[model samples]
Target: MRNWTISGTLTVEPAEQRTDLLAEPVAKALAALESPDAGVVEIDPELADTGAFCEAYSSPMSASANCVVVAGKRAGEVRYAAALVLATTRADVNGVIKRRLDVRKASFAPMDEAVELTGMAYGGITPVGLPADWPILIDKAVADSPELVIGSGIRGGKLLVTGELLASLPGAEVIEDLAKPVA
Candidate 1:
């Protein structure tokens, strides 16, 4: 276990760094959560819908929604930003993120760029392991779900938690009108 808590910073690092969710990792985290409410659900990696359902979609699963975190550099300075967009819609990157990052121009960091800097799998990118300075953009839709499955530091696994719980994670912030459903 590689769990760590910042005594003054109010942050927590996992005890062990697992690539994805297995029964063991899930079970351990479930037991560790302050509130153990959401149930475990298995998802297939090959199917985008499955990942979306378990990780981003909210209909099939009671607690699920989309998440997109953008990282990039502007004017020779590095920045990390994220959006917990509902799977139903795509992020309004130009609308919300540009202002949030305080730049006239902004875009989703390349997949390779995000993976390299965040040190988390593309699909597995969660707010948990994110850098302290990163800014998060959470969708209002998440409030509707009882719980939501976000990344678990690994693409193959998910962390099932309540919306409130997810909000409670370190470096997480709730944003209203962050995006609109994709047409």
Candidate 2:
């Protein structure tokens, strides 16, 4: 349990308190993972995007994990997955992800579709409350990190969670090389 602190400027709160803006599923998921090591920090909604959040809060880009929703078709059925990768890397969507989904192609889900389906705002979707059937592919590095900053299902806050806890979340799967280094 490393000390998980947002830069001094942000106010930390029990994750449960900020659930008002979370989609129902996300709120429920966060509730289940409530623990001393897991909490939320509220920030300016304007800085919710990963780059801004990290720069504004002075959080290391390596410690921030982005949860991206990807969609593909397999067997004439639409399939979706949530890919978790550190800000320093990119999910291997066209390589590892396409193979995993057994789809001919895979791409980021349409912003509108992702937002509507996850009940989370664009740029604020976290893996915590994704549909049960969706696979949550967490890069090995992210799952091995002692602590990470992730979305709180809304643009107004960020969640602090341990790698172990995140890996234990429902549907989470830690995969080696799930992401490729950004070059």
Candidate 3:
């Protein structure tokens, strides 16, 4: 399944790539840069053992980019949002996310359900392929980075791009409080 999305370049959007959880961020990215290598694979054996996150592999400043998918209750409506943050710190959902969406309770989407609904593997859900209705939050830190290695709409690879470009994704909403300080 991963191989299906691992194409060199695409001439048209594939239906199987779309999902209710997120938009096809990578496709927009491809159109943005006009370069296919914008998203590439890093299949080093060391990374294979690091689980879904990359913070443990290096400092937050050096880690690959990450985004958090949140399922919450907003305005009496059950909604979903994705927050892009560096793995060094956790997404400040209660303080950052809750306040932005005017929601009372915002929590990380359950792992089992996140993978199932997002249509991506546990560690591979990217901002792309997310539903249009869902709000995507970008941490200031992510926007500050020179480039980010975010998920490439798949589990086996990631897209390395400028933080500013990521912020420009059609439905992305940039916000502060992407994380909490290390205690």
What are the lDDT scores of the predictions, listed in order?
Answer: 0.57, 0.85, 0.61
Off by over 4 Å in 1: 1-42, 48-63
Q: Per-residue CA lDDT of candidate 2, range 1-183, in tens?
A: 345654446656666776765657778887776463566887789999889998888888888999999999988999999999998999999999999989999999999999998988887899888888999999999999887889878888788877788899888989999999999
**Ten residues in sequence with the least summed lDDT for candidate 2:** 1-10
**Runs of candidate 2 exceeding 4 Å displacement:** 6-8, 34-36
Which RMSD values do the candidates have, in order? 8.8, 1.8, 7.4
Find the candidate with the highest TM-score and give its number: 2
N/CA/C clash count, model 2: 0
**TM-score, every prediction:** 0.70, 0.93, 0.70
The TM-score of predicted model 2 comes to 0.93
- For each of the candidates, give the backbone clash count: 12, 0, 10
In the predicted model 3, the residue pairs found to clash are: 21-130, 21-131, 22-129, 22-130, 22-131, 23-128, 23-129, 23-130, 24-129, 25-128
Best by lDDT: 2
